[model samples]
Target: MNIKEASSRLGISARAIRFYEEKGLIQPAKQSSNGYRTYTENDIWRLQTIAALREIGMSLQDITHALAEIDQGNQQGLEEYLELQQAVMYAQWVELKRMMDTTQRMMDLNRQDGSLDVSHLHELAGSARRLREARQNWHDRWNYDQQAAIHDQRVQAGKTKEDKPFSLYHNYDEALEQTVQWISPVSGEAGLDIGTGTGNLAGRMLNQSAVMTGMDQSREMLRTCRRKYPQMHVKLGNFLALPFADHSFDFVVSSFAFHHLGPEQQQLALEEIQRVLKASGTSRICLTDLMFTDSAHRDAYSRYAATTGDAEQQRALRERHFPLLGELCNWLGYLGYETKHIRHNELLHTVLAVPRP
Candidate 1:
């Protein structure tokens, strides 16, 4: 069968089939005179098996290794891999349940006076911070001091029109332009950029004469941001516990950073963003990481990750808990925000949200 036929029969896309081939996961039996690849029944079965493994949350690397073992007739290794995956999935389920319980507790604290108990909210925030700190490994993954030293070089390389290291790093100028356009920073308005790595987003807002303050967990990154933009304020902070008062900014923005956080942390970060924004204020944000819209999409991302050779990045990808777009939208609605998905791509998402009156 041709690629299209295989795709149709398996309920997968032609692009996905090509992706598997690119990863060396499948090989067609022949190439026709027209230069089309042809697959055999065995190939189709192999593809179907791969899709099934992916649906079960197996990473591409894991799937590849398991398949190789299976081809060699080693069923024991496959069983071991499945056991490990089951443990990981169970842990994630527990964490999710904890987050849900926390949310419910917070909701229960709302008084009959239509006001939230400030002290109770603070306690919940502290719980969230603790949960995130326990699960997060970014401090170990990123060497902020080293990254800061080469920050300008990396940014310049990313801006070049030639081959780039990663899609997120490609076309730096274009990405920044799109972020600024989506944010639409107003002159003299106060804005905050969370996880402001090297102040890229903050700098764009500052160019519009907006009062921009940047926050990041890495002190070294904040130092770089300060040296580059002396006029803007840079703070050493994390998303779970923002170092600012309530309703402090007219707008808030973040770019390519939230994926470092766990699902619970993402929710806590959004709450903090909303807290720091003035009533009816907007937040235009971009997330450049894997987003799992469904099981199939999650599997597709795992395959994409297999193509990358960066071990640290691959580990981060494995550890990261991507929040589903629908779940995020629901969270926004529950928090009294009107949310709009500005752009949804395979590995990126842009959203514009405003507090509802």
Candidate 2:
């Protein structure tokens, strides 16, 4: 039969048959006289098998390799191929089960309050789970020796404020101006700036509040803060595992740092914030990163992020910085913080969440 006849009989498109040929899964019988392609029952069976395997997620390379082995009269090839497909199917089934389990849990959360749906709860659970994992990893990896090495590295980098082309900070400053304008900072007893890079917020709070503490994981960053704002108390710490006691601060704020972490880290940090803030305290987390609308920002941000790290570490470093706003919000809410305000205007996006009073 001709290619068209075989394709019509199989109830598959001619285009798909051509694609299978391109992938080296099936070869049409070549004709010499008019150079017309011919298809036999063997080819039809092969195409059907290929289509079935593809529907079950067999990759092009695997299909092609298996076809070659089968053509070479290797009887075990078909068995091996089936086994590979079975393994993939099992893995997919496992993932589907996990998704269903998560979905069921979400339904329960939503049943408690009809305001949230599946997507919202899924995001929350995923974020919270990831946070626990990251915290566990950090606890396992951190030791006195690692801390000493980090401290030494901080000392070696030296507190030099060179002209680094960081667009994040520039955008952050713009956002901060707009945020402070709309909601005036009502002075509280004390405030904490979690992950206070360069002490920008802490610097602003120094004069405005009774006492302000800048908390960051990087000693180098705290050193920079110490140089610029001697009055504000700076401590090296992680947001996920804050060092302060419960109800330690009246107000907690983080600027453009939450997205650096995955959903898990953000939620853990949120729970930590909830644990530490006063009952009536407020928390504002300012997020200044690429929005869902800003496609160009990722390329620019990625290229610029490369300069901050050595060549060996640039790719991983860039991956760490970029995150979507929706995921960030889902994490915040899942960790039990009420999202009071969310603003995304121009290129800056900010979210403010307060613990339940």
Candidate 3:
């Protein structure tokens, strides 16, 4: 349809549509005969998404970013964008409510006394602004972004007394090699490594001639990964929601990053792994991280931690989401995949999955 038709269909003015195009929000094809712009159904839907986001107070820049994320294979991009906007609106609500409460308190003061004190009102408003500003900023508990630079260095710092946090990283190098070996990379095959911090696991497969794509949640880690393997593909994504199309890779692997997710996210991540792998029977999923042999193993570890009175170890044990080996296998089985557990050590292990017959 022509610009007029699109504007009519969208119930938006042609000028507004032109303005959106000027902001690089949409690109309509030009008719070959008259060079007139034409909009397709996809373009119209894109425009609708933009309009909806703008209605909710998203800046043009924010809308552009959300659209780009969707282009990059985040199928849940709209939901994620809405969640971010919700956070922003919630912050704005706090600021507005704080100001409103201060106004009410000032009104209360006037009701109790003959007149309002301008200086006292100013102080209350200032305090409210400061508190609202402080409450608006959110920080990650792990601080992975800040730690990206030294992530490779601190993996097996070996500074622990006996039991320590992230003991899975203790055999980091060996684990990476074993994971790569387990993958048995074949030339010309497409492979993806999730939570591929600093390209540790992905880089090991360079000589195997397989096309490797590394994905991580931390941008700084991706920067380092790019520096380490310039030819390898690197993407910014998390486990629970992958930024790739369905059935996109021949095999999928991950290293040392899955434990960061909670139980539900872990299960969701498993489904995502299954979704992204190709339909061929030989397609596989391999993962390496800290895991218990089973429920009994987890109980023994908890009991050992308590008996030792090592406060730090106990805290680490409490904080980490170490999966049970049996649970992982069962989840894979339920997902139509056969799973094999490989224990590298008492605390470190790997799990490989292939589609069941």
Q: What is candidate 2's lDDT per residue for 1-357, written digit by digit as tens?
A: 987898889988999888877867788888999888899888989988788878878888888877777789875556556555654454344334445777687767878844756677768678646544676554312233344334434423422324533333334455655545433456655778877766766677665654888876654566667778878877656666666666787777776566566555555566677767776645444444434323465567566656675442354344454455555566767766666444444334666665555
Candidate 1 regions off by >4 Å?
Answer: 1-140, 159-166, 281-290, 307-313, 319-322
lDDT of 2: 0.62
lDDT of 2 at 293: 29
> At residue 312, what lDDT does model 2 achieve?
25
lDDT-sorted candidate list, best first: 3, 1, 2
The whole-model lDDT of each prediction reads: 0.72, 0.62, 0.79
List pairs with backbone clashes in candidate 1. Answer: none
lDDT of 1 by residue, 1-357 (tens): 888998999999999999999999998866656788998999999999899989989899989988998898887567546654554564465456567878887877874466676888899979866875655543426566678778768767654435433344544565566667767878888888887878888998899999999977665787788788989987666666566766788888777677777777687678767767777535444333335665677777777778867564477567666667777777888888777664434545566666665
Candidate 3 lDDT (Cα, whole model)? 0.79
On lDDT, the candidate that comes out on top is 3
Task: Supply candidate 3's per-residue lDDT for 88.
Answer: 60
Candidate 2 C-alpha error for residue 123, in Å: 17
lDDT of 1: 0.72
